[model samples]
Target: MSRPFRSVLYIPASKERALEKARELAADAIIFDLEDAVAPDEKVAARATLSRFLAEVDYGPRLRIVRINGFDTEWGRGDALHFGALAGVDAILVPKVDGPADLDAVAALTGKPLWAMLETAKGMLNAGAIAGHGRLEGMVMGTNDLAKELGSRFRADRMPLQPALGLCLLAAKAEGRVIVDGVYNAFKDEAGLRAECEQGRDMGFDGKTLVHPLQLPVANEIFAPSPDEVTLARRQIAAYAEARAAGQGVAVLDGKIVENLHVAGAEAVLAKAEAIAALAE
Candidate 1:
């Protein structure tokens, strides 16, 4: 089945206003953060706050996720254990995931779908194995951590991370799992944000992990099928249908061969667009 998980927004667990604001946002998923966002002294309080909020809030149809700290950290394990039994959490985002073992350990702790973060060098190297892990639901790119760990400069085009990005995409696609792009750090530059969102879309991400509400619209717009694209997809499907009725295995559309594979691709695009449109209504 096609899951609508576009525009995943990150809401810091320590920020009450941010958590409340998520209820009113149009994100398809909300990632409640217990790592990076909270200070060392605030970890305990943050976990309690997140648990209480999750237990009490009505998140409607939006998927609720919690980004726990790395398994190596005490705070991370504590965050996972505290909310692992909570009812509303749809998935647990495990950072610094290096291999299948990490996923296995988390799955053992909670049956919740694991959204493994491909951040470190080891994680990138083992992306295929990690994605193939039995209980993984998806993969999220942790570009900032990855950049730091790899000692790579962040170019505007993200040239340094291309290999890692491709590996994550290949692994996720092979396993039939959702793949989301990393957050664009520049929240204030709307134009730059939109450009990066478009870049992520071009790279074949299912959606983008957003750090701010303003980024939501850009990610949604970039990921959503354009009117022209939808029209062409429909045309391709109809042409393929006519060809099939005539006992032909392939047909020519816009000077390109339209086969069963092409028809399936077109239909998938239409389905994704329809699902996204339905969410708006």
Candidate 2:
């Protein structure tokens, strides 16, 4: 079964407490951030700490990803080399990824799956090429950096970022790669966070990157199939089965046609839900 990567939580490498607390969180993945989260002087120490943490922690079934410094930085190579050596490390997240060359360079260096963070205008423009690059497992929306680079204000519906978002989704879907939406900066605004999570789900994101623990529930709720949806999916599967037994080629349920494609989609949803529930238990 494909692992469920529904809620990705970012923890600062320098914040030991936050890193420790991650063990108790329900996020599907934990991103050990060494770029924007660490100061220049703290980079060396954070790398050491993160290296030790990765070597020691089990992180249960949650995927472990390290967000290394941009490849252009002085400490980028060091961070990549150290974190890439860990046994449990699932993927390396490369920040400010501009093109396929950047992704290829990192993938070659680490020999691990690379998640390219599209955070700039150049990155957005070349998203398709980057997603198609070798060893690229996914692309992440870096909304804050994209907004800063474009000098555009944020809106509730993300009108300014629609094109970029759509492009990333298209490329990711084409390559069968995961696409995670960016974090909502406001940790205390639960309502706003939920709204944005719902919007991300509606926009075809596989999941969302979260900055705080409170956002975990919202992300999980938004990404997981709802009760009504699950019921409908179940009905679709049953209808298809009954039709096939009756030697009927076409099946209709609730005035809508149910084909192989619909049955496959419903099965996928049910499979994911079952996997998540099994993991929780």
Candidate 3:
């Protein structure tokens, strides 16, 4: 089944309480972060904590990913080297990926699928090559770092980030890789998060990366197909089928013509809804 990545939550490996709480979180996937979320002194210990937990506990139906430090860093190489032994991990998410070479290095160290972080300007330029990597499964936006690199402030409309985000999205989609949007930093602000989530959805992101558990419900809701959307999709498909049966060239639903393209889009909505339902199960 195609997994629903509508809400991917990042949990700090150094925090025992947060890690414990993650087990019951409703996020579609869990990124047990050993990189940005952990302090320098705690990197090694965080790795051990995450490794032990993965080997022992089950995260239920959610996809379990581990975000390691950059390969250029001391801790990054160690994280990749030991991931093969970390049972129950679904994939290895590498931070600050600039090109295919970064992914190639990590792939050599472990056999798991690699998820590259599309954060740096250099990475944005080489997105196609990064997404085209044989072992790459998806790309995650690193908005905070990207914003810093671009020297742009956070605007609710995200005008400054559009070009870069679009380039990354196009590269990922062109290669059939699943691409998720970057996180909304204000974890405590539901109104802001909802607006940003809606924007991300409208812009074609499969999902949004989240920082806190409190943001999960909003992200999950914003990304998933709504009841009205599912209804329209079903109606469109049925109308098209009925038209085809009667030897008509086109079908009309709610006064709009439904073509082959419309049917395909409708089918995709239903497929996504079904996938979300599977995750709930």
Candidate 4:
């Protein structure tokens, strides 16, 4: 089973305090942000700080993805070359990836698995090619930038962002890569955050990228398979097994048909639950 990324928190690499504090957080993954979080003047120093921190400290079980500056920026190439072969880094997240060509540029600098930030209109349009890139392992929604690019207003349901979100999501799924939802800006609002987490979970996001530690519990709880879901999955699997034993193609479970497809989904739910359980250990 794949690792669960239910709560991915972004920690500014320039802040020693934030990096130290992140070691204790229950987030499934940590994005050591080297892009927007760092100031232009501090960018160079932040890289050294992050490299030293990763070498000296241990962030167990959780993934360590470094989000490098976009190739459009002067610092982008340096960021990639610096963190590309860094020991603790798990993946290199390339921001504003417009197509596989963008991945190609970064791939030349690093042999590490890549993650793309699908924020631009052109990136969203070329999502399929980007997601299919051999080195790409995941996709992250950059909603704030995408909104700015579209000159769109924020709605409670994020209706304006649906098309872009769906396009990237479909592309990621088609290519069998993990896709996470964007951060909800109002980090302090627990109710609003929970609502959005539920939406992302229902929309098939592997997780939600978080802005603050306060948002972790809600995202983790909402994204994880619920107790009822686990129970239902167990029942479905049992029913399907019994049907197959009887040389039947489908089984009736709680008035619904359970076929091989349903069993496959049920297995995935159980596998995810198991994976989440293991993450806690």
Better of 1 and 4 by TM-score: 4
* Residue range 1-281, candidate 4, lDDT tens digits: 29998999999999999999998999999999999899999999999999999998899899999999999899999989989989899999999888999999999999999999999999999999999999999999999999999999999899999999999999999999999999999999999999999999999999999999999999999999999999999999999999999999999999999999988999999999999999888
What is candidate 2's lDDT per residue for 150-172, written digit by digit as tens?
A: 99898988899898999999989
With candidate 1 superimposed using the best TM-score fit, by how many Å does residue 175's alpha carbon deviate from the native?
0.8
Q: Deviation in angstroms for 152 in model 1?
A: 0.9
Quote the positional error of residue 145 for candidate 2 in Å: 0.1
- Provide the lDDT at 212 for model 2: 88
* lDDT scores in order: 0.88, 0.88, 0.91, 0.94
Tens-digit lDDT track of model 3 for 2-37: 878899999998888888788888989889999999
Q: Cα lDDT for residue 112, model 3?
A: 93
Query: Which is the leading candidate under TM-score?
Result: 4
TM of each candidate vs. truth:
0.97, 0.97, 0.98, 0.99
With a 3 Å backbone cut-off (N, CA, C), the pairs that clash in candidate 3 are: none
Any residue pairs clashing in model 1, and if so which? none
